[model samples]
Target chain A: MIQVVVNFTERTYNGFMKVKQKLEILADAAKYDASCASSGTEQRNSRNGKGIGSTTGAGICHSYAPDGRCISLLKILLTNFCLFDCVYCVNRVSSNVPRARFSIEEVVQLTLAFYRRNYIEGLFLSSGIIQSPDYTMEQVVEVARILREEHDFRGYIHLKTIPDASPDLLARAGRYADRLSINIELPTAAGLSALAPEKDAGAIRISMAGLRERIDASKDKTASGKCPPRFSPGGQSTQMIVGADASDDRTILTTSADLYGQYRLRRVYYSAFSPIPDASPMLPLQSPPLIREHRLYQADWLMRFYGFEAHEIITSEHGMLALDMDPKTAWAIQNRAMFPVDLNRASKSTLLRVPGLGVRNVQRILTARRVRAVRLDDLVRMHAPVSRMLPFIQLPDYHPGATLDAASLPARLREVPTVPQQLGLFM
Target chain B: MHTVYLEHETDMEGWRYAARQLIRLEVAPQEVSWCVKSAREPGIQGDIFAMPDSRSGSDCSSQEWAISNHAGREVVGISQYHGKTDVTSSTIFPEQLAPSTHADHLMVPRQFIELARSVILHQAPERFYLLYRVLWRLQRERGLMRLAGDADVARLHAMTKSVRRDMHKMKAFVRFREAIVAGQPRYLAWFEPEHHIMAAIAPFFIGRFATMDWTIMSPNMGMNWDGDVLQFLPGGKLEALPAEDDSEVLWLSYYRHIFNPARLKLKAMQKEMPKKYWHNLPEAELIDSMIAEAGTRTQAMLQRAPELPRRKIIGYKRGPQRPDITGGNE
Candidate 1:
């Protein structure tokens, strides 16, 4: 009787510790990734009494972490064990961080449980390369496959794909995942090779190009007009580590613009390098360039939405974005000659270049002007920042006057330090 | 002067009936007052007892008073009981009143109707009066909505925006806790909303969580789904439902673990999930401890030295086999 009781206690303790340790290790290992978005997928729901979740066109942030990042998905690694020696990755084989691997069942149960509680939209399953990239890829895809097919979970699933995995494996991954991303890791091939010796930049691009082709083919219909099977209907996205290597903001933007054009990517996430537990002797021991990351996102918005080219936005001599001011305001001040853009006569593209007027306000202006002349009060009523707009735009009742030429324009344009300018709130 | 009492706070049909009658009677918007039957207005209540004096020959008949009261309206007297005959005077029917009317004759924009539908859901005592005022003005001013700067149009837009925001918040914040009801799994959630939006937002939850049995309770209303049909319940003080479950345990675990100690943007997190919501969220219990430990954890990571590498534990051998995509068919 004594022996049986002791064994039972021992087994319970081990089981409890193993799951808790695994969660701590795996979640810590996965936190460096910046992509927690669960948006831009095909809208689906399980209203037929078959499944338990739904995905709308726009994703909802179930919670917000103190990192200011959204917690829309239960982002985690299938396992933290790795064979690759990516120096920047805390999960890299060379690192001394304690490792753990979650069983496939644990992952599925965790996702479903978290989802049922409305803690998450779905799973974003990633893994460190274990055994081989192919083996690791298969393990990751199996989690998604089980959640989608066996459980009939109609929620968002974003799988991180290994570029080295076989095309066949990639194809199957596309079938199950709403989104697939392969990290570019670094901006330049030299930077990538120097830091992550095992990763090949060429191979990553090849996989991206392959993914894009398959994504495009799936979207196209055959001559019979039959729709092809859905393959990543949410499209593809990629992430690049900003401060880990020697690449500057200009280089990063160039790579991002290229990726957006080449891969038809939905988003390019910039993750500022967070120093991990074990220090790399060669990397800089400074604060993570968070402001730089924020500015890059702003610059990216300009490129995608405002029609600003990558070459035009970079102002600092070092090819780095200005830390104090937003890229749009910096560009507007740099080209002061384009100031006092006539709100009545300026084209959509020119109006978009204004610092304060966002894409929505500009569209509203164009639409409203067709009906009647837009005054300053009309702009204010639309909730446009009149203080920011007064320096750059001319309305029927108001103009910049001499303020456009004032030397304090840059200081005035600079965002007040205390206020948090949320990036996507304007649009 | 005229008084129209609505049967329900959010009763659009009742509102439309009163509006059409008032317009037909040539009663200008300022000449009429609109109040809900259940609204807590003492003046409206006193107006009901005062109605007996306006009756022609009845000796304070309680039945006549009951019909006249309609939760209290002084001007709408015993004639309310004999409605179709007593109130239908040729003078009450304007020359423009036609059984079949054109949309152009109303001159109210389709936009104003959409705005009114959302605005009427608001709990403001003046909402009905404000909407009627806008509708009355729209007939004279065709381009009223186009003036986004106009106070009435702007107020209309503001109310609609507030209701829409509440609906979106409901969509984002409702957290369901799994419970066993009748030996079957049912999800229960409690939410506090600032507006009368439970009816407006229930269909979204029904459509989303259709397969699962669930109940969403708010201060104003409650909605329940039983796999096939959805039912509404009058809401009061919410009884403490099952607050903890195995699923919530894992959810809280994930929440505690997923937060990065390095980045502490408390303002941003609070901006989205305000402290008011933090009380109900299972994960929110971890937030204070997470914030407290974040700085120290970040410092420790920053200060830790490069430890000597441990012997790597070998997992699967990289065999000659490539991952077969065809394997998925099974």
Candidate 2:
């Protein structure tokens, strides 16, 4: 009797320990992909008391990892075992890293447990290809199926779709997930062929096009004027691994522009390549400057919001963005002829081009000018950077004068102190 | 000078009632003072029924207020206070004290009401006075809210922005720990919010975690939901909740592993998840070590020579194969 009791306790301990170990390995493997947004989905709630989750159309960052990334979801892989030998991936078959595979039930339980404790908004499930593309996609979809159907989860779910999966499987994935994404892997086709030989650039594009079509179809009303079944209501997004290849800033931006234009993607995430445990020799030894990734994001935002085209953003002689100043400042310096815009009368698009005036401040200026003349005090009240906008905008109380034509303008603008590259070890 | 004492800090109804009455009396902004009745010193009686003497004529020059309020009858304008009669008897002033003998119109821009709703949640004691001053000016300055350059409007916007941020942070940072109460599972959390937003954010929590039995306790208030109704009670001590749970170990592991050591941006993390929230977060304990070891870890990865390929890389091969029990995908 004593022996049986001890065995029962030991079995339960091992079961719990196994989950902890698997969670550590799988989450570490999946950290390379950088799409953690949980917002912009259909608003849902558990107010009916049938489920235990809700989404407010605005993503909430439940926690921030030490890497400064948003920890909004339980981002993990079903398994860290990959058959494909992608040089940039840590889970390539050749890599000698510890591997783990979570059972479908384990992923469901983990998601519920974390969500119940307010630890995450929902689950972000991705996995390495096992058996075949269909099988792996099936397993990933099954996790969502259980979460949505059996548990009646109403929270956000972002599923990473495999390009090689069938359209039927992808459709089912979209049905269960709030958002779907497929990693573009690399910027250029040649770079992808060289590093990740197994992943087909053509196939990825086709999958994205398919997703776009379905997403569009989902928004249309049927003949009966009834809404069609939802398909990735939050829309599809993709990620490109920056610094993995010799792609320049211009090339990266151009590729992103094409992705946005072609697929109508909600977002194109740029992930700075960091070192892995068993990295390939084919890849660069050092990670690219983190600022490079930051600049790309800034430039990407300009395209999406400020109406700046890709070619116009990278007009500098070098293909790389200037490390000293932001992409907007660089663009403004390059196009000095467009400066000294009138804050009281400039169009919304022109005002958006001003270096320091954000979308919100621009809107405020537009509204304030309607009621009364906008003055320098108005900009100050709006928290607009006075010195930064002085050379770019004209108001009734303040004018750029020769500041826009001054040769020292760029240097003066760049004179702002740069953020330290890294923090001290002990401090 | 007339003083108006509200019942609590977040008494928007009381503030609205008193402001309307003051505006009806044509009381200058400076002549009226706002105070919370409970916050007064001991033995000091709250002037809850203090009403300024009524002016002889309405002189309600605000055309927008008249057009919107005086659609059918002149007496209906005073009846608008009937809905808010439960707030205080002062709101239901005698008809003889009506600002206008014909039509008593006291209305500001709809935008002002929304701004005051958020600004009133701020912890600043001067918030009520600022709001009242803005309301008094809005009656005259129809486009006052649009003039962002005005000091009162700027202060209102700033206070509203702070309250909204506090509410958002409360939503983002509240961490629940699982516990058993009366042999039933319940999730409990303790947070210290910067403003009087406990009631404002309760609906969000209730809507999200409706099916579960949970309670979010702060220093001043507690919100409890038990699958059916949400109840607001007085705050409780942190000791009443569990310090840790079994799931925390898993959460900490996920936090540690998900962090990319090569790219440490402590500033970015701290900016979003400030030090004030670190104590309540279970994963914050790992941040220091993660930062300390990041440089060494990245350096080691950079210095370590790449291992030779174990086998000649094979092209994509598709087949059905059982997953390796111990490790690899094959």
Highest DockQ model number: 2
lDDT of 2 by residue, B1-330 (tens): 455656566878777877777677565555555656453112223342343343221211111211121113122222344343333232232222334444657667888999999998888877877787788777777788898777779989999999998898888889899888999999999998988888789889988898899998877677788988777767578888786677777888899999899898888999999999999888898889889999999888888888876756556764333232112233
How accurate locally is residue A277 in candidate 2, as Cα lDDT from 0 to 100? 87
DockQ of 1: 0.32
What digit string (tens of lDDT, one per residue) describes model 1 on residues B216-320? Answer: 887656778898887766564556577456556556666777887877888878888888877667678888888999899989988887776687644333334
Interface DockQ of each model? 0.32, 0.37
Residue pairs with clashing backbones, model 1: A66-B265
Q: What is the C-alpha lDDT of each candidate?
A: 0.76, 0.82
**Native contact fraction of candidate 2?**
0.71
Clashes of 1: 1
TM-scores of the models, in the given order? 0.86, 0.89
* Candidate 2 backbone clash number: 0
In terms of lDDT, model 1 sits at 0.76
